[model samples]
Structure formats: C-alpha cells, structure tokens
Target: MAKRIVLFMFMTFTSLVLSGCLVAESKYLKKAEEADALGREAATLQEMHRELSAENGTLKAQLSRVKEEAAVLAKEKEKLSADNRELDQVLRSKTDSLSQTVADLRQKVSDLEDENARLKEEIAAAQKAREENVRQVSKTYEDLLDSMKGEIAQGQVTISELKGKLTVNMVDAILFDSGEAEVKQGGMDVLAKMVDILKGVQDKMIRIEGHTDNVRIIGNLARRFPTNWELSAARAINVARYLQSRGIDPAVLAAVANSEYRPVATNDTGEGRAKNRRIEIVLVPRDAP
Candidate 1:
C-alpha cells in the first residue's frame, strides 16, 4: 500500500504540471492572433495615408495654375484701361483746336469787311473831286470866250462863236504881203496883245494854225519851200515858237498848216483868196489849273 500511494502522488504531480503548461500555451496562442490582426489593420492605414497625400499634392498644383491665369487677366485689364484714357485725352484736344480755329476765321472775316468800307469811302471822295474839277474848267472857258467876243465886236479882228468852241480868222491883207509868210508890224502888235490875254488864262492849251491860197509860189522861193503847204507849216511853227518864247508853256502850244484845203469862201474871187491865206489861234481848257 505504501508503494501504490507514492506512485499515485507522482502521477498527480505530473498531471497538474501538464495542465498548467497547456493553459499557458492557449493564452500565448490567443495573444499571437490579436497581434496578427492589429498588424494587418496598421498596414491598410499606411496605404490609405500614402494615397491621400498624393491626391493633396495634385490639388495644390491645380490651384497654383488657376492663380497664375487670374494674375495675367488682371494685367490685361489694366493695359486696356490705360489705352482708353489716352484716346479720350486726344479727342478732347482735337475738339478744343477746332473751336479755336472757327473763332479765328470769324475775326478775319470781320476785319475784311471793315477794310472794304474804308476803300468805298476813298473812292467816293475821289469821284466828288473829279466832278468839282469839271465844273471849274467849264466856267473858266466860258469867261474867256465872252471876253474874246467883246474884242471882236469892236472891229479889232473878225471872229465867230460856235457851239463848245471858237474860231478866229486873220485875213492875209491885214497881216502879210501877197504869197508871203512874213507878218506886218501891225499884225505882230495884235498878236502880242492876244498872247498877253492867253497868258492870263492858266493851264490853257493854245493851237496856232496857218492857211495858204491855191496860187503857187515861183523861183528860188518855190525850190526852198517846195509847196504852199510847206510855207504854211513854217509860218505856223514860227508863230508857235514866238508864243513859247513869250512865257507860254511849250506843252500848251500846237502848230498846224492847212494849204488851201479848208476855205470859208470860194477861191474864184480875189477877196476869197485873201481870206483863205490867214492864221488862226485857238485856246483849249486843260484838266489841271
């Protein structure tokens, strides 16, 4: 019985020890399973974090591109605004210049009108002076004609009064020898008195005219003179020169010869021939006093 009890105790101790070892092995297995599950979960979380980080980097690049585009648009808008302002300034300057030009044109037109009025006044004054000059010239000629008429009526010389002009006839019998251009002493005295009368009239033009009969000159006198026309011309020129020497303006004297061309009476009679050979003096009114 003592041997059996000892064997029984040894088996019991073996069984208890085996039981504790088995429990410990089970606990270790459970802990290993929990650790494996936790490790798988951690690996999944790491993959998800890597993917999120890559997505965030892509979104940040897109935002940067959008901000660059916005900045370019803002610069373009500023440039357009500056161009519009310059155009507006140019338009305003052109409008002001046009207004000033229009005002200057109006002033020039007004000045031209004033100048035209002054020219009109000057022309009117000149016309008035011309009219007054004509009136004075007419009165002076009429007075001289009347005085000459009175002298002719007193039997000193023969004269005829005509419309707007006068005529004087100096007969050759009273003034010159037959077929001669020389004037007698008495004829010279008469001519001198007429010269004095003509000198009193200022600014008068005087004409001395000589005439001849149809009778021809003969001998050396004919060769020297050629014709009665030449003799008559010489006589008229001599009378004109005498008048010029007697203080008459040379501009006022004219000489002409009419050789038996113009006659007041027929050349058939001796008395008519004598009347044809004569000298005449005419006075004309001048434009200036």
Candidate 2:
C-alpha cells in the first residue's frame, strides 16, 4: 500500500509540472501574436508616412512653379508700363510741334491777306491814273475826226458828233451787197483814209459797228449768213479782220452788230430802212475817266 501511494504522488507531481509548462507556452504564443500584429500596424504607418512625404514634395514643386510664373508676369507688366510712358512722352512732343506749326501757318496766312489787299489798292490807284491820262488824250482824237468831215461828206459818209464822241454811219449800199459781209470796192478807199487819220491817235480803240434791216434770210447763202443779225455781225467782224490784216493792233479793235435796233430814222420808209443797214467805224480812247 505504501509503494502505491508513492507512485500515485509522483504521478500527481508530474501532472502539475506539465500543467505549468502548458500555461507558460500559452502566454508565450499570445505575446508572439501581439508582436506580429504590432509589426503589421508599424508597416502600415510607414507606408502612410511615405505617401504623405511624396504628396508634400509634389505640393512644394507646384508651389515653386506658381511662384516662377507670378514673377514672370510681374516683370512683363513692368516692361509694358515703361513702354506706355515712353509712347506718351513722344505723343506730347509731337502735339506741341503740331500746335506750333499751326500757329505759324495762321500768321503767314494773315500776312498774305494783308499783302493782297495792299496790292489791290495799288492796282486801283494805277488804273485811276491811266484813266485820267486817256481822258486828256481823247480830246485830241476828236479834233482829228472833225478835220476829216469834208472828205467824209464827199465820200457819201455822214459824220455826227454826240456826247464828245464821233459816229460814222456807212450805208450797206456803200459798204456791202444784199445779205453779204463783203465790203465794196469804193468803201475800201474811205476806210483806208479813216485808218490813216486814226493812226495818229495814241492808245486808240477802234470799234466797227454793223446794223441790218429786219429781213428773214433763207437758202444756202442765208444758211451761211443765218439771219440779219448774223449778217451784220459777220460784216463787222470782216471789217475788223481787214483792219487787223492791214497792220492794225488786235487789242485796239472791237466788232459788234445791231439788227434793226439803232435806227436814226423810221424803218417804214425805204430810205430810212436803207439808212438802218449801215456800218460805223468809231475811234475812241482805250480808257476814259
């Protein structure tokens, strides 16, 4: 019985020791699992920290680019402002020069206007002097026409003095044919004598005045003459042309026509109608006061 108790006690002690070792192993396994979980958590934290650092670096790079862009924009703005100031200065200088030029031009225009008025006044004075000289010379011209009165009467040419002027009336029968502008052969001698008398007059203006009776012209000859007025005008022009061809100055000659307007006598009478168709050569001073 004692030997049995001894074996049993030994078995009981072995069981107790085995139970303590199991408890220690269980505690060690729990500590190992906690360590493994801590390691995983630390690895997760490290990954998160790396990602944050990379994002921070990217943000820093973006900020640096933004600062560089801002600096470039600022420099461009300054350059533009400087250019605008320079342009404004140039515009001001040009405006001042233009204003000065306009002022000078206005002064010049005023001076030119004054000079023009002075020149006009001087011209008027000179013209007045010339007219006075012509008036004095006109009396001598009239005296010469009076001296040829006897010769003019013999040639069937009548002379009359009116308003200090002489009028020579030559009939169409003595000067031209019917509806014709040609001067007759006998009229040539009379005109030559008159021209000779007028040659002595200084600054003489000669006018050849023509007149015609009222007659409607028709046919080829009438087409050339057109009307009595045209015929009279042509006759006067022809006489003036003849005088010019005979060495008379063109400046001294003037020709005109009057158709049945300046009749000294009545047109109802044939003799008065004949008298109405006439040519007159008038000698006058070029200018008169």
Query: Which candidate number would show the highest TM-score if scored against the true structure?
Result: 2
What do the candidate models score in CA lDDT, each in turn? 0.73, 0.78
For model 1, the superposed segments whose C-alpha errors exceed 4 Å read: 1-156, 285-289
Which pairs, if any, clash in model 1?
none
Give the clashing residue pairs of candidate 2, or none. none
Task: State every prediction's TM-score relative to the real structure.
Answer: 0.47, 0.48
lDDT (10s digit) by residue, model 2, range 78-194: 999999999999999999998999999999999999999999999899788567645644554465456656656665577765544556777777767676788777667657766
**lDDT tens string, model 1, 1-289?**
9999999998999999999999999999999999999889889988988998898889889889888988998888889888888888888898898889889988988988898898889889867754554444455455544555654565445754443234466666555665556666766665666666567655456777888878888987897678888988887887787778778888888888987898867889987787687887765555522
- Mark the regions of model 2 whose C-alpha exceeds 4 Å error after superposition: 1-151
